[model samples]
Target: MALFSARRGSGLAAWLLAGSLACLLLVLVDASRMAEERTRERAHGRALVARVGLTDLALFNEARYTRHLSQADRHAAFQDHPGALEHFPAGSLAGPARPSP
Candidate 1:
């Protein structure tokens, strides 16, 4: 069996296979960690949306609209039209999620 073992190159192939498996395991662990982080981020986003009482689409639109506007700018935008429907954020008020007839 020594002759066959010598021909097989001293267990290097086995060690290489083990190393490859370890690398794969590390990659999988890293991927799972990234997925967990993304899940937490999504949950936090959902919680904020719920707390503000808005749908995802509405929240996105409002954020985009207000992203460049400062508090004073927003105040000015609304100050001219007090209690106006157009001034109100789409999702801030209670309304149907979908359009109804």
Candidate 2:
């Protein structure tokens, strides 16, 4: 009476096929994870660049406004004073409206 099966090759082939399938699944999962991580990093980098651009624009506008105010002033652009120069305080000249003596 034979207790064990005589065929051994078929079992080995089935095990090898299962192992290969598992390895392929793992590789595909790892590849997809790496792709998703790269996409997320790219989006973060784009947002960082946009934030920097916005900050630069805000700074440029502020500088332009300050220059316009200085040019419109009667003290800085023209270097002229109202009435007497002795009545005004020293180094405080900033606007068109003069301080009354």
Candidate 3:
């Protein structure tokens, strides 16, 4: 059985490689299907954008201040008080608002 045992390891490696290739092929097929769906979605998104008119996309819904950074009032963060700490988790993600010229 020594001769058979020597080939057993190679057999397992070959099966593993074949299984990996099969998985890769499945992923490629799925990606191709998603690509077609993405093209249709892109066209729908363009239509929505045109109908809605140009507006800044809201990134964070956690707080009003973070909802529209470009239009955010710098002093709005201290609406509660002058020394209030940032309570919303999204507040930390945004940097200080730029001062208007």
User: Which structure among the candidates has the greatest TM-score?
Assistant: 3
- What is the per-residue lDDT of model 3 for residues 3-25, given as tens digits with 9 covering 90 to 100? 43436997667778878999999
**Which of 2 and 3 is the better model by TM-score?**
3
- Residue-pair clash count for candidate 2: 0
Off by over 4 Å in 3: 1-7, 69-86, 92-101
lDDT of 3: 0.71
**Reference-based TM-score of each model:** 0.34, 0.34, 0.57
Q: Which window of ten consecutive residues has the lowest lDDT sum in model 1?
A: 91-100
lDDT (tens digit, per residue) of candidate 1 on 10-87: 566666777899999999989989999999899987998789875435332454434333222343334445443444
Q: Please write out the lDDT profile of model 2 over residues 1-101, one tens digit for every residue.
A: 13232356666676678789999999998998999999998897679878775332222222332344433345443345543342234233333445459
Give the alpha-carbon lDDT of every model: 0.55, 0.53, 0.71
* Model 1 global lDDT (CA atoms, 0 to 1): 0.55
Q: Tell me how far the alpha carbon of residue 39 in candidate 2 is from the true structure, in angstroms, after superposition.
A: 0.7
Off by over 4 Å in 1: 1-10, 44-101
